[model samples]
Target: MTFVKNVPTQPQILAWLNHVKLFEGLTQDALMPIIENANYMDLKQGDMISYEGMPLSSCFLVLSGQVEVYRNTYLGEEKIFGIFSCYDLVAIAAVFMPHNRFPMTIRAKIDCSVLFLEKNSLLLVCKNNPIIMQRLLISFSAKLYELINNIDWLTSSSAEQRLGAYFLSLSSKQGSQFILPISRGQLATKLGMRYETLSRLISSWRKQKIIAIEGNKVMILNVTYLDELTLPSQRAF
Candidate 1:
């Protein structure tokens, strides 16, 4: 972890805050105070952004790159909860909880920069600002929905079915042709599948000519084929 100096100018900070949906209606002047109290940090790959059970007092905004949020199971195995990328805000709920401790360990997936804002500073701003409070409520609701979606995806079906759905989602997200940002092992763990199982699934897909893989980059050759893999129970969603 490296502290970032030369913080962005007020205008730059305001521009960024404006782009964040949570601050949708906040004015430049309204955001200036929060920006003034913000601390920026640069993190390299493998750096731990936050540790499980650590007391939380700040909310983090990803300036660039990605962070993997995960928890350790009873057997000490890592269970990835989410991957946060650029412009994503994390730990907002934890910051306001009475217990106020991190439930998962957060680690940088690659070199990244993040803006940290003190919880109290943000709460103070929101207290008297109905617009900001509404925004926070909207953001909180979005996160809650996402959490439920993740739980559904995890227990939906077989690894093969899940993998197929994941690939389709990625293709849709990155415009049908994009390189995977994370390693195969990390992805395997994220999808709740064994590393070997993931490799075998990829191999099978490749053999079937459903996708073309060159290193980390994958091109979908058969989108319809992939979509047909949806399980009966998953069809409604």
Candidate 2:
């Protein structure tokens, strides 16, 4: 992990902040304070961005690459909640929640650039601008909906069904040929399956020509066939 103390120019910071959902409609004047006070950090893959139950000193915004938010079960299995990419903010809910502690373990999914904003400075800005508060609420609401969607994968009857749903969701968000954001091991945990189970399902899909996989890159060969596997009746959660 690299601590980048040199701050970006106001114009550069303005461009970056404008892309974030939480600051979508914020004016240049409204965003000045945040940009001026923000600390930039470039994290290497596997670096811990935040730990579960740690005091909320600051919140992060992903400028590039990805971050993984996850938690561990009593048996020490990691349960990946989500992979956050560019223009995404991490731990927005923690900043405003009654309990001021991180809810999940956050790590750099890949080498990433992130902006760190101290909690006190953020709160001061929000107090002066109700719009910022409203934007944050909207962001937190979207996160809640995402968590609801994840429930379906947890209750899938077969690994194939889980993989199909995951692929469909990705295809919907990105194009049909986008690369996997997280590693296969993390993907298995997100789908509540063993790594071997995920690999076997992918292999079976390949045999049927449903998908073509090259390293971490996956291309859906038959979207219709994948759709059939994720019928509403077949979904458990």
Candidate 3:
């Protein structure tokens, strides 16, 4: 991980900030302060961004690449929470929480760049701009909803169901064919299954012609069949 010593120019910062949903409608003047105070960092794959319980003085906006949110299990295995990519805000909720500390560890899934917005700077900006505050609330609420859905998924879904839902989500974003963003081991952890179990399920799916996998790339051969693997009640039309 490398901290960027030379600060980005106002225009450079504005270009990246423009894509962030939190600052969607704010004018140049409203965002100038944040742009001025923002810090940039470059992280290599596997670099630790923060650990669980780390002080949350700032939040990050992913300018490029992916980051994983995860925690260690009692057996010293990693259990992934989520993977976030470009334009995604990391730890926004923690910045506003009473404890103001990260609840999970975050690390770079690939080489990435992130812009850090100090909590104090953000709050000051939100004070004068109600629009920013409203956007923050919307982002926070969406994150909360996602957390609840994830809890339900992990607790109630079968391993195959969980893996199917994960594939479907990737297919939605990258069409029926795309490379897996993380390795099979990491994917297993993300879906809350043992590596051998995940491999067996994928092999079974391949044999059944439900999907095809070539190394890291996956092709969904039968979307319908894969969809059926998920909970019937939760399946989307």
- Per-model TM values vs. the true structure: 0.86, 0.84, 0.89
Better of 1 and 2 by TM-score: 1
Q: What lDDT tens digits, residue by residue, belong to model 3 across residues 1-237?
A: 889889788888888888987787677788877887899999999999999999898889998999999888887778777788999888877887898889999999989999998888888888989987788788778778877778877898889988899898899999999888777887888787899999999999999999999999999999987777775427242
Per-residue CA lDDT of model 1 for 1-237, tens digit only, reads 999778677777777777788787788667766888888899999999889899888888998999888887676667777788898888877877888898889999889988888888788777767887777788788778877876786796789888888888788789678778667877888788898999999999899999999999999998888778854424343
Stretches of candidate 2 off by over 4 Å are: 233-237
Best by TM-score: 3
Residue-level error in angstroms, candidate 2, position 99? 2.2
Cα error, candidate 3, residue 51 (Å): 1.4
* Candidate 1, number of clashes: 0
Over the stretch 119-199, how does candidate 2's per-residue lDDT look in tens digits? 877787798899888877777787677666657545745777778888888888878886887779878877778899999
